[model samples]
Target chain A: MHGECCFESEVLAAVVECRWPERVESELRVHASGCAICADVALLAVALREDREVLKSIAAPPESGRVWWMAQLRARREAEKAASRPITAAQVFGAAATAWFAGACFGASSDWFRSEFVRLASGAESAGIGVFLTSGVGLLLLLAAVSIIILVPAAVWLAVGKD
Target chain B: MFRDATLRDAIAAALAPADSESGSLVESQDVRADFAMDEDSFRSFYDRTARGLWAYLARVTGDRQAADDLLQDAFYRFLRAGTEYESEAHRRNSLYRIATNLARDARRRSVVRPDAVVSGEDIERVAGADSAGSLDLNADVERAMSRLRPNERAMLWLAYAEGEPHVEIADRLGLKVGSLKPLLFRARRKLAGLLRGKDSDHAR
Candidate 1:
């Protein structure tokens, strides 16, 4: 029942056109004076129309060309991101495979690796601090592993940044 | 809308095959390849809707600066949206919906709205220089509208400010058409009461 009036649209149309009580037909003005919904609609519509005008005076939306250019730039950037996804994935896979191959080669190279693997577990547990650093070969391998972990991503990022 | 003749010319220049020696023509062609609407069509659409859309954003967010950001964003998203429109009205509705959502998201991200600078050229000066009552009413309505919920403001605005149909208003706000009437009624009633209260105060 609320907000429902048979004359609501007629009243609304008149208000939108700035006719309302002043210029509308005598019968419609009489009805608006009596109908609660129509009266409220008129009051609200006039106020909002004014507010909209005020806002229009204040708002200066950017030029369409600037908007268009920004959209194009964003689209191109997104395209670059989309195109690089497979390359990024491949980079990660390549790094992992290299690490795995290096591990397998180290495992296969010497009986010393088997003994050292056992020593590594016990040495890491008991002789914690200097265990790897004390062994020259282990120290070299540790530094190499650390360097790759730190460097590969940085290199890729630099490469991407350059592009 | 077609007022930005300079920018339009620049866009035209960029889109045209001039200065091919720099290969910029090829780059611009690639840029156009992914655009949702061509240059002329987009210019026409922007000319038609930009002011209304800007006003809507300004009112809904209660900030002109935010409206600037949201207007550009809405158009960009609209272009990127790439949804086929059945008509100009449909496309306009789509842009409104996008703009509404963006305004909602912006309000959520920043709980405190930036103070909108109501410019020196007041609406009263432009709209009602001769009628003092109308001037007071405009300012009063502005203050009272700030008291409504954003959704309520949006509803009232789309309904009365834009003079949108119930169906278009419903679509723009993503509401069921049946429910929009009562909701609009409550919002209108509240706004009317607030406006009357001001009128009485002015009378005193």
Candidate 2:
């Protein structure tokens, strides 16, 4: 390996640079004519140069309009998908607050309704009919509050997702 | 932080009432206003550069489908950024920079994926399939390229394959202009060695 022909390796560096004058290629060709290794290096350079062209031809990308359109479409789709996932701190906080409010209202109303039912059934009311009417009205108000608390935010969330 | 900004823009774009999907393709008032590049300008830019960029990507990644996906992603990100370029070359360089990063990231990801491993014979067969043996040069080129580092492949491709000047390659790859020449020279020398060593083995 101490006697290795520098042209055998140097020709490759020259070819890779691709700035070699015709004189350089001619000299390399002459040197290659007498040496097998140099010839291989020269061949490699030509093959590489030719390969670039091959890549250019084969890698015909999609049409400009198509590429552009697809990019826009993809961005929009990804954006929409990202928007749908509720992971942001603000979004998480909003959801939590909505859940808590709904849970509190439902719990309080259910507790009151349970107590009212027990009292009404045990005949502990001075005005039994009036008490029943009041309890019925209270239950309706609770149901309305629960519906608003649950439905409004759910509607808002769905609308946000759509947007 | 960059992801956060991208995420924010993406969310904003998503939440806007879409004018129409098809209509949005040619001209999006939202994108145009943000980027300040009208439909014609973008179309013109795309017409001039997309194919070449795609070619660069394909050679770098050695995968046509990956090139396709990256090409789209590159353009989408470029549009999303909305940065004003002083000139077409600057814009082109910026696009290539985005593409280079995307291809690099894709390569990194593929290395981690279990199924990304392909046999040497399979790669050769696929590379050889492009054209008869005349284009078979790419087969060897791709084979040799697989042996090099990703950045080496990129610098070599941009310098030799794409004919980009040293300064431009530097900017695109985030290297200083002074360092680009030596780096590119080293990459070329290394690739030449890889090509010789690998192909010689195949010949035997």
Candidate 3:
């Protein structure tokens, strides 16, 4: 009986690890035929095997698209938030250029600037320097507006896309 | 013998009364019609196995969020692989193979970050009444899983948890069945050692 108990324990370990050999199975059957104690141990091992299989079925993870989708949405939001933080040096440079153009446009309309502009324009034969300044300022303003239109969308798209 | 007869009858009845109007039935029919028809077969297979797949993923990753992402990615790749399955086992084996690869990829991508923290709520949902008692067990399992090479963990889990035959495991994992025995033994020993440690800690 003691030997049977020991053998049964070893079988339990082997079976649990899925290493039970064909010889072990034959030995177990032989032991079970002669000894009731071994038979009981064999039954217990079988029960444990059955229980493990049942536990496996019970432990299986649930599948819900809703849960998975929520996870994906959370990951995507994190990626976007990470992407949206402080602008890089390139972006800062772009923003600085836009701000300078706006400042230049405002400066162009100033009275002191206008008087200096008229004096400079008087040197040019047909059209004053004011015409040159006005056209130049207009072109800068148009360039800034076009940049704002193109860049904001591009930045937003870059931030949200790819992931 | 009687039970086997009953089961066979039950299966036949289940398959016999298929509704033509049902989308799942239509999909199943489409899959059965063509060996080369990959999309419908994959979709049907995913629908059937997603829960089991997620369970395996959650157990492996120990993080519900990571498992969720990995599960979707795994299914996406399975659809793309477009392999014709000869049997139900083949289909399932393919799914697990894809999932294993996805988990490995995710692990490589985020080596520095801590694995997803499994919340108490997640534990309750997965472990149910044994949630409190199994916490240590779950932690031990996860730790053991982390110690294993990704493929080893994948092999051990599919073999033990899924009860896959060695041949199927070999087919799915692309390893010789004989080569897997020693590796599987080592993995199990590692897990058993971890569990023993956890048990001792609880005793203390």
Q: Who wins the TM-score comparison?
A: 1
For candidate 2, report its TM-score.
0.62
Worst 10 residues of 2 chain B by lDDT: B111-120
Which parts of model 3 are misplaced by more than 4 Å? A1-128, A133-163, B1-44, B111-119, B122-136, B200-204
C-alpha lDDT of residue A82 in model 1 = 68
lDDT string for model 1 (B76-195, tens) is 888888777899999999999999999999999994374543654554445545455555555686678788999998999999888999999999999999999888888888888887
Q: Every model's DockQ, to 2 decimals?
A: 0.28, 0.17, 0.04
**Predicted candidate 3 versus true structure: per-residue lDDT over B86-153, tens digit per residue:** 88887788878788777767777873233633544455455456555555455555665667666766
Local error of candidate 1 at residue A46 (angstroms): 0.4
Ranked by TM-score from best down, the candidates are 1, 2, 3
- Sort candidate 1 into its docking category: acceptable
In candidate 3 the C-alpha lDDT for residue B77 amounts to: 55
Candidates 2 and 3: which is better by lDDT?
2
Estimate every model's Cα lDDT from 0 to 1: 0.75, 0.65, 0.55
Task: For candidate 2, write residues A21-122 as lDDT tens digits.
Answer: 353657766776676655544554566566666655555556655555555556556654565465454665776677788777768788775776676666
Q: Write the per-residue lDDT of candidate 1 for residues A1-163, one digit (tens) a residue.
A: 4658898888778878977667888888788778888888777777777667766655577777667766776665566556667767777677667667766766676587666667777888998848867988777766766866777566556545544
